[model samples]
Target: MPGEQQNTSELTVEELLHDAAVDSTDIEVFLNALTRLAVHNLSHPGEELLCGITLLRQKKASTVASSSDRAQKLDEIQYDYADGPCLKAAREQVLVHVPDLQEDARWPEYRETVLEEGVRSILGVPIAIGSGNAAGLNLYSDEKGRFDEEAVESAQQYARQASRALSLAVRLARHRDTEADLQAALESRTTVALAIGIIMGQNRCSHEEAFDLLKSASSSRNIKLRELAADLVASADPSSAGAHFDR
Candidate 1:
């Protein structure tokens, strides 16, 4: 209803991307929406285009989202060979365009496989999201020369416009991950403390002595300290063994 009066084509790139980010509930959902948007907005009329997004974080590249299953499979082929236009664009932060895969000689093995998949032209545009992280927008077309100069420029511009929303999504995901990690740490500490308290009650020993006993048992059993603590707590009181935090 928000765009009922105005056609989607009339929407500015910023508005489109902002709507995508706001509509999504998580990073994965937003990326999927972005790939779908790319295929819809960037593709020429009557031209079939498959879009995929490759994200590079901490020097690792992964296909984060795709407009279709075929696009996802195409992106995975690049990962299998460890060299492809998308990966190259993301790593070098440059655009890589293969107007005709058959004529391209850069990635011999990669080109062969991609050609077999019926992709004739490929365009990879790097998304500039600052902070040591990189991403690339990959477009696959069955028609050779599908991504001509004008099309390439359009794709590049789309990537530039999409970067801001993507950066915010990545930051939100990282924050969620950090919070989850902290919660897990607190739960583990609580479990260990409860286990130590049980040990103290059973042996009538000091807190340090109880902790040493727990550590010695954990080492002897070749089990992690956390696991050992969990087991001890469970054995002592099944109902109260579950990790509980005040927050």
Candidate 2:
């Protein structure tokens, strides 16, 4: 009904995701907003549709976002069994439709479980994120044959429009993660260097000797190098109570 009343097409996927990302603090929150928008725009009058997004990166599958708790649970059921329509669609980069779960013989165990959840119809559309990543847009409905040919086409088209935005989001998330990792590495290196300097001052040893001493202490104590370095720095400089590598 919402899709019928308004021109949902007026809002491009890129714009939708951009708004979501701007309002969200992280990728997970942005993805959650994306699923909610998909459900709102795709559901018809009196037709309760549940939506979920499954992301597979480096061969690991995870339910990244869902429209509701029920949708999240349904996606988890598929992950628990490690075989379901969404996984199939994502892995093969294709659309999978189950008009009637009771009649669909594929994934018998999953079918039984989803049927118990009152989901009679399902649709899974692949989302092309990147080479090492795969994703799927999963839709569930209580009425059998809810996703007819027309509905299937709409879902497919939505997936195509959203895939580019999803890819960009994933890349931005990776970039953020890389930046955080690099910052952490730099902080850790700085702390360790400070610790080495302290060791050299205390023992009047060379830089290499101080490093060897720190390494030996870390090995003997069975503590992480960074943690030991942080502790040493903290002890030497009481003013620096909380070192960068404390975390």
Q: Could you tell me which residue pairs clash in candidate 2?
A: none
Pairs that collide in candidate 1 are none
Candidate 1 residue-wise lDDT at 209: 87
lDDT of each: 0.87, 0.87
Candidate maximizing TM-score: 2
TM-score for candidate 2? 0.89
lDDT of 2: 0.87
Candidate 1 residue lDDT tens string, 43-152: 87887799999999998999899999999999999999998999999999899999999999899998888899999999999998878899999999999999988899
lDDT of 2 at 148: 90
